[model samples]
Target: MTYDLVVIGAGPAGMSAAIKAAKAGAHVAIIDENPVSGGKLLGQLYHEPDSGWWVGRNIAREMIAKASSLGVAIFRKMEIWGIFPKWNIMLNNGERLTTEHVLIATGAAEKAIPVEGWTKPGVMAIGAAQTLTNFHRVKPGKKVVIIGVDPLSLSVAQELKMAGVEVAGIYPPPATEVSSDKSNPKQIIQGLSAMAHLAPNALLKAAGKAANHPTIKNIAAKCYPSFGVKVWGIPLHLRKTITAIEGEKQVEQVRITAIDGNGNQKNGRTKTMGVDCVCISGGLYPLSELAEAAGCDFVYIEELGGHVPLHSPELETTKDGIYVAGNITGIEGAKVAMAQGELAGTAISSRLGLLQKGSDAISEAQVKVQDARANAVITFQQHIESGREKLAQCWHTNVQTSSGKG
Candidate 1:
């Protein structure tokens, strides 16, 4: 089959981009490996403290409906293995599809920090547990201990509780004793600072506004210590770490240890908690293997989930005709992904000559995308704003050098 644009991964990003491009008169098709197209979105059921109930279900429904109404073809259960130049894509089902342009919204894969007994049954990623509970109607376990203190892990803990799973506690991953040269102290500070948002809105605002005053900032900082927020009547243990998961046929108990401020174990003090399941969440990283296969330039921006495709602000990768958006661009949330999808879609439509350059529609789309990004609820990772500036600068430099700017 041939199309003007073939989008891989029918998640928020792919669907948004497809809908935008289709509205601009491009024949678009979206393919995903799952039988359904929602991607991780199908599993996300969390509440935003400010926005009341924030459910991915509503967003996914809207995106799918819009795409369908726009006549954008949706193909599921198709795994793409090869992407040759000139937009030839090979599917695992022995079929091939060609397109004038491609957008990879492959999104991200959950990162698992390996601990002993991780391979045992009943041990899974937080995202997996969420899928089983939210989408499949299967409770992951009767009781659970979650290992991670990020928003995703915390939110999943509450979701699991609502789904009838008894959550023991949420803890941070075992801290590394050895520090690498690549480690950025500022990033650690930034992450810790952002943790204040987990508190009530008033506290978050106080911390942000008081940052300039060292005395006030110190007081504000003191207000937030690890695991400061309780969700669904569950405690998030910030000063604790999971040493191991113990089980025979399935998960039984987890060894928890207390750590000092430096992440070093404190006097070998250990505690054991009995649980039917253990959820490990090291974090999230972009699933950029396909983009790598496409020969896009990659740069290691730790802030944007390790090595991401180096692309222009327009969302075009170093390789022509291939664009990216969503978590694959960085470790952001569904809303950001939707905004990015809109942007990439508009850019692709303009590039395909379906939309005139400098047209009102294109300008409007760009403005809307910018608004969406600015107002996003979750913008994790560090240096995202400056990192984007760096991308633009590098892209401009490359273009000027190619054109003999010197």
Candidate 2:
């Protein structure tokens, strides 16, 4: 079927794009590999302190309903392997789809901290644990020891605790190339400053701000008690980390060791803690392989959470007629992704010459993306504005170079 737009990924961004474009007199179809729509929304559950609870599953259900009502086709459990010449989509199930416009919103992936026994049955990514508890309503473990101290792990640890699971505590990942400065207690404290705005209380917010300064933060980390501090009733161990997961078969225990504030492992100071499961979170990065396969150019911006395809602020990728929204461009919360989806949809519809009367919707949609970012409750990266400026510069440079070639 040749549709006006084919959105790849049923996550917030893709569904929202499908909804927007379909509303603009364009035939839109959305596809996802999961049997159910929602993507990461299937497991997200949290409170905004001011805005009340953010129930992703409920939001996704509402989006699906609205999109379906607008006559947007929805396909589930279909894996797309390639985007061929002339907008041809090759699905894993021997199906081909043709579309005039494509939006890549495949989202981000959890960067794993691969330590010993991490491949065990009970060890999983922090996101997997959230999915098990929130989405599937299943317990990941009785006593869970989480490795890595970040926003995602902290929230999931609280969730597990709320679900009656024993959260041993949040610990740092062992020092490794993959883990980077995340293994450093001091670095973690510094990085925590970026997440300060998301703290639920004023006291934590103050602490987060205080941690941003090098002198104050270093002194704090150096003086940090050997015993971890309890943040929201969950132990946050900045002075120690999980060095290795241990078990005869599955995950039964983990090796913990104290570290200096600078992140050097303290020798002769290792202990074992009994835990049924281990959740590692090395943070998140954009999953842009599909963007690459679609002939999009990419740039590695640390603030955007790794390699992201070069796209304009309008959400159009380097590849003509191909747009990218959400984490395929950068790792961010779902709200921003949805707004970008709207922007991309509006842009796509305008290109199809269907929005002649409502072309102003393009600018409005662009404002929405900015507003969403400014008001984002949880920001994964700091200096997002600067990161965006850098991305824009790259896009302009590429455009100029391409014009010169022509």
- lDDT scores in order: 0.77, 0.87
| Model 1 stretches astray by more than 4 angstroms | 48-52, 177-192, 195-232, 356-360
Per-residue lDDT tens digits for candidate 1, residues 28-52, read 9999999877898888876566677
In angstroms, the error of model 2 at 142 is: 0.9
Total clashing residue pairs per candidate? 0, 0
Q: Kindly provide the TM-score of model 2 when superposed on the true structure, using C-alpha atoms.
A: 0.97
CA error at residue 45 for candidate 2, angstroms = 0.9
- How far is 21's C-alpha from truth in model 2 (Å)? 0.6
- For candidate 1, what is the TM-score? 0.88
For each candidate in turn, the TM-score is: 0.88, 0.97
